[model samples]
Target: MKAETDFDKAEKLYNQKKYSEAKVLFESFLKENPNNYKSIEYLGDIAGHQKDWNEAIKEYKILKNQFPKTANYWYKYGGALGMKAKSVNKFKALGMIDEIESSFLMASKLDLKHIDSRWALVMLYIELPGIVGGSESKAIKYSNELMNLSKVDGYLSKGFIDEYFKRFTKAEMNYKAAHEIGNSKITFQKLYNLYLNKIKDKFKAQKLKEQFEK
Candidate 1:
């Protein structure tokens, strides 16, 4: 009961964004309750939020080993690895790509309805260069998969890819479609940026921005 009480306090601190304080409490709690999955998960999340990717990776790796079948654990592990790759040399980043991809893939396979894993794959495929495992086809494939699961996310992913390629018209179209489907603030923001930056239509951009603000 005392351990649970302490953990709840630590979690409240984490929720309040007192990450450093929360980390100390969580660490102490884990020392007493080594197999507490929730504490371990929060420790990993705290490390990631603090941009301590190595520590995040280490914590998530423990979670992955402890909960091999849990999709969320693998997804988080992949996400941490992806963030770590962004901060490293190109060669090192390249080496991490396979592990990152494998983790996301495992998560997706474990839970077909895991939208976060699919979204991560879409971004990964779009951001990496072809020489190092990125593929436009793979991006489109995941986008299609997301579409099958959630029309709004699918269109948003497609818009993101088109925007990346500077295909402003296609991006605008997809963003509009996503907006029609979900009216999400994110879709409006993307449309606002597209009109302001790529289409150079301040009027449309202002309207989109206003919609986003609402």
Candidate 2:
């Protein structure tokens, strides 16, 4: 009962974003209840939020090993790995690519409706060099899958790809389609960014801001 209470308190701290406090309690709880998956997940999240990627990866790796069927664990592991790769030298980053791809792939396969994993894959395919296995077609394939799952995600992802390739006009059109269908902050932000950043159409951006405000 005491252990459960301690865990509950720790969880509340984490929810409140008192990460340093929660981390201490979680670490102590972990020593006493080594197999508590939720506690381990919280520690991993705190580590990620703090940019302690190695610790995050270590914690998530433990969870994925213990719960191989849990799609979110794999996704968390992959996300940590991707972030770590970005902070390293290009050679090191390249070496980590396969693991990152495989982890996200497993998550996507396990949960067909996982929008984030598909988005990760779309970005990965678009960003990877051709020699290392980048493919616009593969990115498009995942974008199409997202379309079937959620129109907003589908169009946003497609717009992201177009923007990456500097196809500003196509990106604008896709973002517009997404905003038209979704009409949410996420869609609005994408369109506003394209207008203000890539296309540099200040008038359109102001117009979008006014409309969104109303």
Candidate 3:
């Protein structure tokens, strides 16, 4: 009970944006409950938010191993692996990407509601170098599927809907939906403009016209 209380306090601190203090408390909590999956998950989250992808991968992997049946654990493990892959060499990144896809696929199989896995897979396909794993067509297909699915409520759906799929006209439409939903103006603007930027291909006239036509 005390441990749970401490964990709650640390979580509250994290929510309040007191990262350093939250880290300290979470660390203290983990000293007594080293295998607590939730604590491990939160540690991974804090590390990710700090851009400490290696640490995030470690903690999330531990949680995934400890809780194999939990789709959330695998999804987070894949997400951390994806982030960590960015800093590794190409061969190593490909290996990590494989791990990421495998883990996310497992998560998706366990729970179709695991939208984060879907988004992560699409992101990996889109962002990877062509020689590594990139495929624009695959990215577009996954993104479209995710967009359609995002209309229903669940983890990552709202952000994926507004940020990933909302291209040009769709984005303009979502901007209105975001506002109606009382989403932060700054967040909505970032999503709206970011999508426009992506579809525009550096505002290349031919590319913009082509995508606009699509």
Tens digits of lDDT, candidate 3, 145-164: 66566642222233434454
lDDT of the structure predicted as candidate 3 = 0.69
Q: Which ten residues in a row have the lowest lDDT in candidate 1?
A: 1-10
Q: Give the per-residue lDDT digits (tens) of candidate 2, residues 115-195.
A: 999999999999999899899999999999999999999999999999999999999999999999999999999999999
Candidates' C-alpha lDDT: 0.93, 0.95, 0.69
Assess every candidate by TM-score: 0.95, 0.96, 0.69
Candidates 1 and 3 compared by lDDT, better number: 1
Cα miss at 172, model 2 (Å)? 1.0
Clashes of each: 0, 0, 0
Better of 2 and 3 by lDDT: 2
Off by over 4 Å in 1: 1-4, 211-214
Best by lDDT: 2
